[model samples]
Target: MTRGKWVAGAVLSAAILVALVVAGVRIWDVHQMTSDWALWPKEVPSKVQFANRDYQCGANPMPNTHSLDGLTKQGKTAGGADIYSAAPGTQSGTATWIVIKTGQATYTCDLMGGP
Candidate 1:
């Protein structure tokens, strides 16, 4: 191959390698986070953030209002649990949630923000 063509090929290969490395690292980090969620502290938290959408509860059933994942501000539920939206100006994201109870007063936020 010509010298100029060889140089171009080398540069392109390097760029692709770098991009792959970045993507792999991100996927690994997410996997680690998801695995660690099983050990999530069972405490009433003011705010919750979980990378995995599914919250594991063998026999425990999540509340109906808490199951929906979306934006909410001053949102009220039939169970009388007050909720607030995480980001006010963003559109709703598609994800499911299962409320896992911690203690007497802690809120178990599943899959991110709520409706």
Candidate 2:
């Protein structure tokens, strides 16, 4: 190929590579953000929950209760967040609140599930 053709092909290839990388990064970021709990579970006494202090509950007052019974149970704990559920049971709907504290951070959320 001529010199000009070679240079054009190189530039095109570089652009395509950069585009692919940007796309991949965006996809990964979306997955990470959605998978982790941003707030629902509780709060940290020192720090607020993800820029949201409007719903800061001190602790998991009703820990044993099955908010959802069978559908899906979700909560925040120890600055971490989780969801739980039972199997082969009636759907009692979901509970509304769960909270946990760790050092300077808190995780809080409303759960829905259990008998």
Candidate 3:
């Protein structure tokens, strides 16, 4: 092959390689974003990078009873359910909240104006 032909082939190969790399990165990013898109009750926290935006857990209050049954305070994700917490007994204004999760989905309670 002539010198000119060899240079042209090298440039073309380099361009194709770059294009493939860029395309691969884009495809991987899209897949990651959409994989968690279908999660229930979408409320991702600020620290999470998988989401496009940060969200504060709304105040979803529990029912009349403060059921602390069979749950540890400051529990781990291993609970496989919503974690519950509340202020001391019978206090007029105590923050009662639940950190609920199912599968990979997790979110804080959106209690109605109760801190």
Candidate 1 residues lying further than 4 Å off, grouped into runs, are 35-63, 66-115
| 2 versus 3: better lDDT goes to | 3
For model 3, what is the alpha-carbon lDDT of residue 105? 49
Model 2: how large is the Cα RMSD against the reference?
10.8
- Give the Cα error of residue 85 in candidate 3, in Å: 24
Give the TM-scores of the predictions, in the order they appear: 0.37, 0.34, 0.33
Cα lDDT of model 2 by residue, 7-70, tens digit: 9999999999999898777655543433333332232322223212223233333233334433
For model 3, residues 1-115, the per-residue Cα lDDT tens digits are 9999999999999999999898777655543432232223223321122112222343342234434554344433222344444434634554444544444544654443335
User: What local lDDT does model 3 show for residue 51?
Assistant: 14
Residue 61 of model 1 has an lDDT of: 33
C-alpha displacement of 87 in model 3, angstroms? 25
What lDDT tens digits, residue by residue, belong to model 1 across residues 3-67? 99999999999999999898777655544533333223223222333432333322233433343
Cα error, candidate 3, residue 82 (Å): 27
lDDT of 3: 0.43
Positional deviation of residue 109's Cα in model 1 after best superposition, in angstroms: 7.0
The CA lDDT of each predicted structure is 0.43, 0.41, 0.43
